[model samples]
Target: MQLLTTYMVRSQQKFATIFLISRGFTFQTMDFQGKYHIHCLMQLDLKFSLSFNSFTGNVPADLGSLRNLTKVTFSYNQLQTRPDGLSFVTDLTNCTKLQLLDFGHNKFKGEIPASIANFTNTLHILLLGSNQITGNIPPEIENLNGLQLLTIYNNSISGEIPYGIGKLRNLMDLSLWGNRISGPIPSSLGNATQLLKVQLQENHLEGNIPLSLGQCRQLLLLALSDNNLNDTIPKEVIGLSSLCIIFDVARNFLTGPLPLEVGNMSKIVDVDLSNNRLTGEIPTTLSQCLMLQYLDMAGNLFEGGIPPSLRTLNGLQYLNLSRNRLSGQIPIYFKNFTMLEMLDLSFNSLEGEVPQEGIFIDTKRISIIGNKELCGGIKELGLPACKVHNTKKRRKLPKLKVSITVTVLFFIMLTCLIVVVYWRRKSATRPSTALPTEERFLKVSYAELRQATDEFSPSNLIGQGSHSSVYRGILDGNQLVAVKVLNLRQKGALKSFLAECEALRNIRHRNLVNIITVCSSIDFTGAEFKALIYDLMQNGSLEQWLHSSENQSDMPKLTLIQRLDIAIDVAFALEYLHHHCQTSIIHGDLKPSNVLLDHDMVAHVCDFGLARFLCGSTNLDASQCQASSSGLKGTIGYIAPEYGLGSTSSLLGDMYSFGILLLETFTGITPTDVMFKDKWTLHQFVKAALLEGTKILDPSLLSSEHLAGINGGQSGDVDKVRLEEGVAAVLRIGVLCSEELPVERMDMVNALSELCAVREKFLRHGM
Candidate 1:
């Protein structure tokens, strides 16, 4: 036997390697007794293979000496782990070129080692399923950036999925089902945009199925049944038009109406929404999924007659709509379902004469039991005959009531027309401003501004600045405008008014706020009046989104992608000012409050009250701004460090302001927060997080997903790794631009380019 083993090892080693790598469980030996001796083989990088063998004992720890080993499999064996856990798996670190390893379907018992992450980046597939392996999945597993698949199912492994796993950019499949894994499915999973299949069913995972998963436009199958998951399924998931395979989330605590967007998944084959606590009627829009088969929506609270549109799914098989509140006659279309193998509509309120043809001819293939109202299929089934109801006629509305309704609608339209005609004539009769120019689109008087803004009412006020207050107003032309009314009582109000006018007088860009018209006239009381008019932003300011004030709670949140676009918009505005414009204009204040969003959610950089044009190299014109002083021209917490020391407002100073703006926007933490006390600035706070490897991002950024075009599917960013890297780049730019020394800062041109690249990579492939 020893001679035969020696000859086989020498002559067939290379051929066996090819066969072992090509197949699984092909070397079973029922007559195998005691431990199959692995040490007796001529050891030249043993690419081992095994099957359902009785080979008992610890996996040899000497595989470290077989440095050239590439593929190894010992599935369905009796191999067990030593008392110290899978410590031998650590020895494979020496085999740096190793690619694939499988120990599944074995008797191996112990915790997976964190050191397994130390394996070569080429190691793409690792299977440890059907074992007694236990303990938490180590967070260090994120280091395996090249891993395409990781299957550790049917094990006793426990604990939360590490948040860092979102960094696996190449990961395509992750199967951790039938384990003891608990805690929330990481929203970061959405960042793995390449992910195709995820099997996490029959686990203890809880929390909402992240809406971010909608970003996986390439996702095919998702199985998440038998978990502690609860929450209304995100409509984005239903709108995943690419989810053409099975969509199973049964046996969960999910609630709320399934969104009508479910119709978007028209090509899905198998759908199982059974045993959930979902409410509301089955969406009739579900008729759009025509390729459906093996549909199981049993044990839900669905009501209403099944939509007749479902008759289109002619290939349906194995349908189970049992234990629901569904009512109405069973559709006759069931008799035509030639491919249907099983049909269970039990415990429902179905009432009809069941068809005698098709699957209904055999009681064994279908179950209509517990539905008391159902009757008459076949004599062998022994059901009572169904009864028909008498028909009734419908009533019509009174002619007198209909005539009165029409008269009221006519008067309402007539009144609106009269009001519109009066306003248009009034607008034509008297122009508002003391001086109206063709350059401006709209011209309005003090009274017109006052009237449009509800008599300068407090309710119409949208923003407040140091020298001005902005009020939302609608012109006679039905156009929305933001009226920046200057406070003559303030110290620098006059200079700020001139600075803003001069700064905006020549430059024009889409991202820059558009000036509609200015009003420089007196009121009825004969007091001074000066106001700047610009396009009214429908979505409000970035400040409201980041840190919403008390009165504005309904403001929609900004996702990572939206914020990135806003950053780029602001960058474009800044780039045009510093390079594209006739002269370099410094936006002295670049805080969140100064950035507004138009109706389309496109960002526009606003407020140029502190803007200054560079006359030459290092000098900011004296008349342009009173910015070179300890008091500073811009708001505190955003002013460049040099500004506090009485330094001139150069282009570099603007870079510093933009730097602080980026940090505040991404972190969602104000520069003036109490945490930045004791000489600890926001710059240092973010710099520390990056340098220390303790990554931090806005809580909203992490929780949100990339839901583009599906009911305003907007979240932070789509890909987590790209998100992490993109954020790191932005923060690094912030640090460099906000550096104490002006020369150390990143230039605006380069910064703009860097920002554009970040957007390109992060948003290249999301919904």
Candidate 2:
């Protein structure tokens, strides 16, 4: 190893070519002493990988001596461009067979040299992201016609994206977010028919979204948020059928009615057009989007009632129409939105009594705030009681009319008697709880999961939390799933497994983790193999976003809107479990790690290991609710203060945990962060920061310059004190919900209401 580092023994090992790669393990920086021992192996024509290492210092120009190199990956290292700058890139042009150049997540800086055009024609991917690289994308880059992916996001690259980028006819992915790039999207981009994902958000780009982009029929993800783009969204762009992943155009100056062509994107899973000037009624044609799951049209000028056709979307999970001019009664057919979890209709001119059916039964699941004319929901919403007027004027009825009325009443009585008798007999024979309520997507045996997860291999493991080790697996139907194998040996693990089954059996909500099936069969060893299966979340858990260091460079940090959405999602899930379900459930352990994000970043609350039934009523005491279970109710840092006094878990405890979660999400500091000592806590830290307007806010939230305009800087811009007020209001709710005294803490409905109020301000003024 020493000789390999120094090149002193290159004569003895002239055949050495490839370097060992480090992944999933940390390594200390080892000085290269400016050596290039691998140059002797130029005849071997081997690939070199020094990725995921801690190597530091500038790229040595001596590396150019390896003319036979075909792939060079120095990703996730501290390597940078030499002080002479980008000269190393000029040297790499000598490697005639080079096909891949990956220098992502490094300290590389300075302009990409025009000499990049000299790279071998075989080069297909240029991954130079997460660096300090600056300067315009040179038009010479178009020479790499064979390039498929070019990602330089999260860099200091600026100036208009070279129109030549569209000339890369074979390009499949183009990501240039988190830069200062300005100028309209090139119409020539339509020429790249193979493009799959295009993310140009968080830039200074202005002008209309080019209609030519619709020509890229293979596009799956199109994100153009946090830009200065203005004008009406073209109908051509809205009709793309292949945009099935996500279509986000939020935080722009878009105007005009939503195109009816939106219905053509039937396969898309998520759509966001919030914070725009769009007007006119929502297109009823949206009903044609059968696969839509998440829809957000908040912060727009849309008027008129929500189209009744929206009820036809059985798979829809989230819907937000808040902060709009939408007026009219809430649609009665909303009761048929069976899978809908969260609905926000706040800050609208909607009228009429709020419905008390389906998701509407939970005041926490629906928001009618700012609609003063709305009346009557569940008692918790505080809407006025609906009025009834009984004024009967009996006119002398004709003999024929009286005779018909009497006959109809006689038959109604006879039918009622028969139904009562039949129902009584049926009720005596079977219990209501015996009926299956939760939908099962599939049923698979333990053996199938074993095969799917390679006999429970360690490499298949995706998570190990809440007494269950979750493994990634693909079933026979090509369905991706997360198989959570229980650790029954742990204390309370068996009980938790049973509790989860009971809790999920009769409950279904879109924001809650959707369970596919459960396995209770014996393993190959004849011991029990208890496991729960769910849809595999592509983004993993919120904890991974908040703290995971393994892939921080690769994963995008959560934005303010994303954080708000996730917080709202968790609240909806909690509201459903606590107040909407047939039997109230207390998610005893509510924390960031338990919240999972699907592919579209929609949150799904998971991990029911500490979940339990709140049998009696909403006001049940902790001991009464936990009589059937034993052991601690929550994780150490998130456990309610009352729980430490030997009290059993309650819904209020879950609210407390949720409050902490909200605080952590914004501050990017967990309750157990080392900064808290003595009497200080996460609450105290935030409380102090709120007063001082200190920069305790997460840096990721401040990355976009536009936020300063939305968030109302300390100078107090009048167009948006509402934004600052909303921020303070969110922190206040966090404090109030997590108060030490349970009696003083707000209920889930009130907490939800406060959040909606804050969210309304954010949407209406802060965008």
Misplaced by over 4 Å in model 1 are 1-34, 37-46, 388-767
Full-model lDDT for every candidate: 0.79, 0.80
Choose the strongest candidate by TM-score.
2
lDDT of 2 at 713: 47
Q: Give the per-residue lDDT of model 1 (tens digit) for 1-767.
A: 11112122221122122232221222333222465444432234445565545556777776666666777787776788877778878877777777888889887888888898887487888899999988999898999977988999999989999998888988899999999999999999999988889899989999999998887877878899999999998887766766778889999999988886676676789889999987788765576576788799999998988766567567898899999998998888888899999999999998978889998998899998988888888998789987766566556669998899999999999999998798679768753432324544566799989866757766457789779999876666245678999998999898889889978876789999999878899978899999998988867888889997543332457877788888889888998999877667888888888999987889999999888887563434664444433256788788888888878778898898889889888889888998988889998899899899777778766654433342345433434565677778878887887887899999988988888887787666452
- What TM-score does each of the candidates earn? 0.48, 0.49
Tell how far residue 93 is off in model 2, in angstroms: 1.0
Pairs that clash in candidate 1: 191-720, 432-444, 432-445, 559-715, 559-716, 560-715, 560-716, 561-716, 707-713
Best by lDDT: 2
